[model samples]
Target: MRLGPVLHREGAFGGAGKRLGLGWDVAGTVDATGVATAWGVGDEVVALDHGMVKPLGTHAEYVVVDAGAVAVAPRATAAAHAAHAATLPLNGLTAAQALDLLDLAPGASLLVTGAAGAVGGYAVQLAAHRGLAVTALARAGDAELVRSLGARHLVTDLAEVPGGAVSGGGVDAVLDAAVLGEPALAWVRDGGAYAGVVPQSGPDPVRGIRVAAVEVAADGARLAELVRLVDEGVLTLRVAETYALDDAAKAHARLAAGGVRGRLVLVPGAGS
Candidate 1:
């Protein structure tokens, strides 16, 4: 979900008198609102900003979003997997922001903590696409999957490379998408950068490295680029399962259980 400082009252999960849809991702067609010049009526889109529309709705047939918070979704796979597109915005944008913060040179090395998770998965792919060598910290079983995503190296346990043993001194930067907190900062080289998804934990700088927490903002242009990656088969979205909108409680339970490969989606017209 969209998060600001705990002291900040406006957030996706806070400052709420009423809450509508709880998800941070959504994919659907624009209603009859032809006023949105970038998105016309009936245009399929994936809405971001943690799905916090003004009136607060996404699990229903209609959702209101800022004009800049949506990207045109590709039609090739939308028919079969519209729900999958719903998983892109929050995690995908977070990943994109993490990479942008790093800004490493081409052929540089990167370490992505929690590389098997949603945001980390995209980070790995995008890092690879940027010509950076990626070392993915994932479970043993995800080795092949991460390898396919362009990670040149894999470490099953973070402890194995406490101080960047995987790449001699350390990687050029780290994208800590799994919220590994300060502990993951050890993987970066001196003068390198670390971008964490959760800032509340407050990572200390190590060995002259720069550290920053990523806050995903709505950018329709960037989202459109990500969508194009999916359209071209450069990035892949995984869906753990789908539930009817009414079964959202059950979906939350499944998420809490953990070990989910991708995302859990709720469809409006589907049955429980």
Candidate 2:
């Protein structure tokens, strides 16, 4: 999600970006019974906000997640199996929200950039499930991955696409998960909509299109819907690679390499 350019000058603090940087969304285990009275110890959770008061994170073992931010992990989803799902909730929610802004009804066409990444994964699936024709654009070797998510069309290069999409007809909306600054805006269909994890420089719809950034928030009800998809086998989590928590630096390197193809998770010690 696009973070606000927080400005702290003198004794005054102000947030830049209309609705950016709501907070962080994280996941971990409930180490205590305090924050969320409804949550309990041993419940695998995903949460939003800061750990200090709002939402505890999953950056470590035995994290103190806020109860309001917690959700029981899908049955059989071992906490140690992957961090993909742990990191998925926030990004997935962001993409779902952005797609909804397009207001395209079922059977409409939608385009997605960076289909190989975490948030991009949910974009493809949700759009498809809503009966929209999904066209996924990603790096080479990512075609098959996005295809499994219900994308009808796929492309390796944006240059190969015409009219803002691979199908040559363009799509009703463009979900630009891979923000590359200003030049990336060219992918949106003329008079359509553009959405990204980063806020667009132009707030208004360009060429009669709508443009906006996504900020993920806490929503148990939405999380349940996503989990239901996983339970029913409509959605699948992909772990590109795993690393020990101590090797988080290495994990970051792998993620920056750009061909990892899925979520890179950190595993705690003792074979967790």
Candidate 3:
């Protein structure tokens, strides 16, 4: 598919040495390649192939990708699907794989930091759907929203979780989306685990607690399932704002200003 709108994330890997046009999340239309049979002509798809410090052209008008990297979104209108496809790949997969690292049993308890953000928000919902009792730590304003997403315990701050000397003593696992670093380790039980998105900044293991740094990989099958959930209303994606490609810097600025609940999308040209 030719690239159209791409998603912008702050503090993403490869940001220090790079500028725009290096984003991994993208929503675009199928091109005229003979390989369009699976995706079809005029199909709206989300193609994820951008990598850290790698060749990334999704910010431009076109990006060459294999069929395995893209997923067609038929359930949503153009604008809505742009928002969904722009987000479904990276954050959704991160949340899914992060929870997989926890390997929690049914009825297990989980604490998700930054529960109002994109990855954390989806983690809250997906974990809850998997029968894990989720405790969401986010701003007070997002309490009701997180609760509706299936977070049982709502705390405005991570400090609300009492620190314990050992693992398996506090919550069962911690999905550290807020980048709490070592401080989040105290919230996990003696045998529990801590899953962080950033590997280099992940906490050191202690008290028999496992530390896992989640690495997101593109799985078209997984993306398709996530899209189905979105279409079925089981999963809801939020778009904080949409900007034309030329105004991508503005989207980055808005994301940097903080308190964004969803993603910032960059349309290739003039956007609605």
Candidate 4:
């Protein structure tokens, strides 16, 4: 189980007395298989349950996921494991799909807000790997972190972005991972693109800029590629903390308190 921003929001303000399950990412060994499925019992796997409202979530010890949504887990390395792999499905896919939406070519200038956050960090790494000129907007303290993630430029303040980075005097596109909305949109050149993480809630298009929010979908093939990247060291994973699955409430509280640098994972049968 993994803690995500959406899970925090849902537990905090998703209304009371509802029995909705609250998780999207899961990594574990397959305990069973259905007829005609390619997966077998005992396959180490990772999957995204992919829904805002569901009767059951991936937070549990056992979860039911579509065969198409599951991928072979990353081979454990000295620095990573199922906990790290758990952080990949939702956040990694969101970044990859958002980049797909932006559709920028190599050498195009791009800005990513919240560059230190989970999705934003992945966006920085993936965008740089694709050869985009990435300017990351994150806290002053995170300059080194974002830089290590492959950001070509780092800005503590949005106003620090240089106008000459692009031919149009603004970034060719903006991946608004911080959800700065209109403020972030202002940094995009006319006729450029903007991609937000929230589905259908992005700012309206202006200055001929194309604006769209990513609604991350489950893609096992794409997820497998990401897992391979992790193994190849093309991608990095960080786990901020771990908790026993029963301590979910405490985990949620920590998430609400903010300042988490990496993902908080819930380990089944873990101690305190």
List TM-scores for all candidates, in order. Answer: 0.87, 0.79, 0.88, 0.92
Model 3: lDDT of residue 142: 94
Give the C-alpha lDDT of model 3.
Answer: 0.76
TM-score of 4: 0.92
In model 3, which residue pairs have backbone atoms overlapping below 3 Å? 167-189, 167-190, 168-189, 168-190, 169-189
Give the better candidate number (1 or 4) by lDDT: 4
Model 1, 170-214: lDDT tens digits are 778889876676667776777888888864444888678888887
Count clashes in each candidate, considering only residues at least 3 apart in sequence or on different chains: 0, 2, 5, 0
- Please provide, for model 3 over 1-272, each residue's C-alpha lDDT reduced to its tens digit, 9 standing for 90 to 100: 00112222332454565654456777777766663446677788886774655546566677777678778763773744575568777788889989988899889889999898888889998999889989898888998989988899898766687444343468989999887878778878887888987645588898888899887777788888888888887777788777888886787677766778888877787664
Per-residue lDDT for 50-128 in model 4, tens only? 8765677777888899999999988862223678878899999999999999999999999999899888999999999
For candidate 2, give the lDDT of residue 117: 75
For model 2, what is the error of residue 195's alpha carbon versus the real structure, in angstroms, after optimal superposition?
A: 0.6
RMSD of each: 3.8, 5.6, 4.4, 3.1
210-265, model 2: which lDDT tens digit per residue? 77776556677677677677777777777777777777567655665555566766
Global lDDT scores for all candidate models:
0.77, 0.64, 0.76, 0.85
Once fitted onto the true fold, the runs of candidate 4 whose alpha carbons sit more than 4 angstroms away are 1-18, 77-80, 164-167
Scanning candidate 2 in windows of ten residues, the lowest lDDT window is 3-12
